[model samples]
Target: MGDWFQTIVDVQATPQEAETLAADVRSWLISSGIVSAEPTHCVLGADVGHPPGPRAETAVDPSGWSVPWHDGLAITVGRTVFDAGQGDPMAVTCPHCSTTTHLADERFELKYEVWEPFREVVRGWDEGDDIVIACPACTQPVEPTSWRWTDDYFVLAYLGFTFWNWPPLRPQFVDDLARHLADHRTVLLEGKL
Candidate 1:
């Protein structure tokens, strides 16, 4: 089976503040006994990451499995594009008129004509270009980051915390983490890779 991961992305963290916020959040996690202070090669797609600490169970839902199957937390800092690691997003909902534009057809095939525009803009966004796409429905300019993707399939952020193969994290735990993130808006993106 493929490895599963859940990433909590700080959507509002600016590029300049990302490193500091990542360090602060990492410290909080370590102090809370959610992860170890030392980094190890326990995470996927990274050279090192903090492993589960003594009180790791405190971060997960009590009703769910508490034993971790794989690795631990990997904090990514910088301009990056994070997704479900599966495929293209099925659709995107514009924040302007609450209009959802479908990127896939009835047969679950990606509609390149519709997805191409988003793809180009997302690429530019990842490259540190401030780009906005006009809503196909409302004809209003909208930042790609403000648009919600299906299943949180796209997260363009400066900072992200990836937890690999851990049990379902408690909602309270996520909230606490967000508080440590200077109360910035966060998004959870989960999928198997």
Candidate 2:
């Protein structure tokens, strides 16, 4: 019978430092009379997207694994091996697209937190606009769907989200979470939509 809240903080820190910051924030919440919060259970490494840009790595054989670059290029796994008499660089399969084009890493890591809002008159809120939703699978824009309570907890959903990852911290993810919570709040708590 109360509104729920989820916050996502994206940071570039070591896992230990990140955990410390999360714990500190949680403690601060409790001290400030915010609802009790918990850190996400795990960290996930995933590729966000790759836009067309200047080439960063030479295309080489796909025999080895590819690595990501921040500028949207993936470095070939190994140095280019030229044929006995040719100068054309070898081609590799793009991991994200599977095309015969050169492949790159373009991957990043993210963390998620699930906070439970357990009381009436949820307070200390901010408006969310200019939110961006990107598909975890395709990295395309997605619409927010709904949120549901599950296993005595709340989870957010998007077009491609699963129970494995819920309550995405971005505005788009939050919108999806809000929709999920509204749709299944009754079912989650009462067994019916």
Candidate 3:
């Protein structure tokens, strides 16, 4: 399991609009000092180009969706793109009952397939479809919110900012990003592998 967190902004724009939005996001990253045009003080001490290296799904240490759909328009911090399950992934507490459900526990193994749905459903979800996943602990139909139990197993989008091992995204950042992309739909995805 990997501790994966991504801030995905669904671009319903045409190709040109997408490019424009990407540029704006890049400018925001540079101006806000979140990232630098030139390598400043980062873990690797070098300007790691877009999409960096070593894909995350290869069952390797620190791999992710590093495809360079837009060359200079991706945000990846730290040497590792994402941390492995941040230790114990899928350990969620039922909001309705407050009962913690360990998804990885042998007892709840039944919900494994249910949680990880088909890739296309995930894509629809990323596009703003409301998907409810049941909690093994209380059997509550929970919707995805931050690190909640309905957290997406996969998301398909053209633009995403992945924070490796970072805590649930700060509200200010979410608000700011939402403000910037007012016309497009934005979804915060918490990934665990």
lDDT of 3 at 73: 23
Instruction: Encode model 3's per-residue lDDT on 1-193: one tens digit a residue.
Output: 3334444544343334555666676666566654455532222213543332222222122234353222222453211112223333455555577766554656534355534542223444555564566665666676543223334332334455544443345556666666666457666665554
Model 1: what TM-score?
Answer: 0.94
Candidate 2: which stretches are off by over 4 Å? 1-5, 37-193
**lDDT at 153 for candidate 3?**
31
Question: Higher TM-score: candidate 1 or 3?
Answer: 1
The residue pairs in collision within model 3 are: 1-85, 2-84, 2-85, 3-85, 56-63, 56-64
TM-score of each: 0.94, 0.19, 0.44
Candidate 1 lDDT over 1-193, as tens digits, reads 7788889999999889999999899888999899999999999999999999989889876475655455999999998898899776899999889999999999889999999989887888888886888999999998867888989999888899999988888899899999999999999998888
Query: What is the Å distance of residue 84 in model 2 from its true position?
Result: 49
TM-score: the better of candidates 2 and 3: 3
lDDT of 1 at 161: 96
Model 2: what TM-score? 0.19
